[model samples]
Target: MRTMMTRRQLLQSIGSGFGMMSFAGLEAASDPLAARQPHFPARAKHVIYLFLNGGPSQVDTFDPKPALTRFHGTSAPSGNLKTERKTGALLKSPFAFRRHGQSGLEFSEIFPKLGACADDLCVIRSMYTERPNHEPSLFMFNCGHVLPGHPSMGSWLTYGLGTFNRNLPGYVVLCPGVPVIGPQLWTSAYLPAIHQGTYLPNNESEPEKLIQHLRNRNLSAEEQRRQLDLLASLNRLHLEREGGDAQLEGRIQSMEVAYRMQSEAMDALDVSREPAAVRARYGDGDFARGCLIARRLVERGVRMVQVYYGNGQPWDNHDDIQIHRRLAATSDAPMAALLQDLKASGLLKETIVLIGGEFGRTPSVEVSGLVRVQNGRDHNNHGFSILMAGGGVKGGLAYGSTDEFGFKAVEKRTHPHDVHATILHLMGMDHTKLTYRHAGRDFRLTDVAGTVVRDIIA
Candidate 1:
């Protein structure tokens, strides 16, 4: 009979994979959230951003305007300051709008699944941005400025709250091809290089390629562990000899996380491990998988997960509105499933979910209306719609609205800064207080403007 190996001897000879399954081992398993402590106890420990990429038309999805149906194919009621395009008569949504849940919130048929979760959602109908174009507006929405060079919200979260998961990055971004502005939306900017989001490609669900730079073939698990253990010891010895060096210390910690992540991160993003019914619910598509992965990462203590819906202007339907119908279908169910799954798993109470784009489309048709069938609208920056749920928001509520014809935001308007402020509030960080001294002045996610919308808070 073979003699039983001691714990240390086993670790030296075998791998940590088998050991990571045990609770005691997991407890001893390097705490992933070592750096992710919030400034205070937070209402939301995690965030999932359902970015719609190019913009979705409000009239066709969340906000319905019967008034527009009354005047379809004619110039709208609102005068001047209109979209800078060929104006057409008001066009009603092609799909029907029905009141859902006890909230009686009206959602167009385009997103049947998301509408079901209406009671848990706080839809902001009067969201407005400063840019009508895709790139600048996208940047502004994620980084707080139309130009890049600014830390993204995720970066800010990591900087302020640290991270719950040391093995994985504090923030993760899932995109297939590219967002309108690409990496700028998740860049670290003035923050430390480590605060930048870890980008996971859309098709990375494959076991072999799920995580880049994590698959190492030259060494066995025991060999790698030995190397990291030796390196960590050397780092500690050097730190003690040098007295104290923060930069060197941070590097030491980063190296340890990178070493341990080979096992932890791989398991975190493996969507294949999900049961068939579970995968089917999210839909067997890139966006769907992205949503599923978002849940897994956040559950594993990742702070923020941004799931971009499609590649290169999927929602930028300028010439054909019907084409948008397809894009809408692609995102609808997976987004809804993410919410439902989170709720059932009891994660929704502490996880904030957001859905919107850079801006919305014009109420009036611009291109696809041969003189009528698909009346595609131009990009509209003056007004749009955004949805929020969980993370300390009161559900079954609509914070603001546009005009009767859905031309512009008329009341209770919420700006991008307000959204930024609210998110920080949920994370227990006062947007005003979470500042970093850089470029000769203190910088923050809200820049110089931001007021947490008190009305939306429960």
Candidate 2:
């Protein structure tokens, strides 16, 4: 018996590792690179991650604490929690929180529409990170590693599942510009190039500006077709001779897939085709447009769609927290409408929608004597919050939480690793079992610590 190797296999081997002490320490299951099998029967087939680029303050959004109002401008009741910069005093939330929906979930005044869909959200208020800074936290949030170079969550999903639809990419990421930590978060790392995310910015709206090298102006369709045909023949020959080469086979499949996708993907991108009424509901910003495009792609079988709000550190409200009103307004309605639309169209059952950022803002004020109309908060990886909906997640419930001042997670603390595990679980992939071997050690997305929170699973 002979074993064949291709770029995909080689990279996967590197991902899982052939080295010592790599995969052994992780909490995941034994075999990390056993041909990517499903953990159990899958309840959902796709995922849409509404990545809030800057960390959104949980207190201002999902987790509402009345104590902040009662004790305005004071300390955090003498707790060990510390902010990045020395803070003056605890600032009370200028915005009030209200309970909404049948589940009676609580949300700040900024998100009335999202509050209307509270029952659909599994709000986890106790999510923490290993770092307080933006770069590492962003990397950790998307790649399960504080260090760079690991495969992103999107890349992992694409690698684990080749994709239900070959015409469109398995992993799609939408953002206006470079984000914190740059492309590392969505990178495929050691995975095959095909598994990496297909990034589309706001300018990609038009077919002419969508992808840089995608549409070749130099060659006509017939010419490009001939080039791809020739390349496909060479790749197939290499694959046949190599005997089960993952990379070569993937390339062969990818070229034809790319060719088929040009028109189809462009068509899905054309939101103008949608009714005027539907477009208004999603808002008119570039981010909102991306969200609408995401819906179309997911409907057409794209596996994972991550629509990031704002560019680098927009949510980093260090000086004035009051300004979050603008940020909150940008994300709130479109997210709620997305949930309702998915539910109404029956797509929610098979699609998972998640909203949150790397971490939450600190409870204290940070700017110089600026009147705290809307104060800014520092990064708090100790305990932030995230809102999850659709897919198999039960409607109308909140899971996990932080302490009284919304500083740290006290009960049902859900770490980023746990969230990763749960996301994998929702897609029916066992986090422990999904491994890639790299540098002689087995590598997994969980990186030695993760357990799918069964309670949150519907």
Q: lDDT winner among the candidates?
A: 1
Model 2's number of clashes is: 30
Candidate 2 lDDT at 9 equals 52
Model 2: residues with Cα > 4 Å off, grouped in runs: 1-4, 7-37, 216-223, 232-257, 367-374
TM-score of each: 0.86, 0.87
Name the runs in model 1 displaced over 4 angstroms.
1-40, 80-86, 225-256, 367-374
Instruction: Give every collision pair in model 1.
Output: 32-165, 32-166, 33-164, 33-165, 35-163, 36-162, 36-163, 73-89, 74-89, 369-372
**After aligning candidate 1 to the native by TM-score, how far in Å is the CA of 323 from where it should be?**
1.8
Report RMSD for candidate 1. Answer: 8.6
Report the C-alpha lDDT of model 1 over 315-414, residue by residue, as the tens digit. 8776667877788788888988999999999999999999999999887877433335455877888888999998888899988999887768999988
> Alpha-carbon error at 177 in model 2, in Å?
1.0
lDDT, candidate 2, at 442:
81
Scored by TM-score, the top model is 2
Alpha-carbon RMSD of each model: 8.6, 7.4
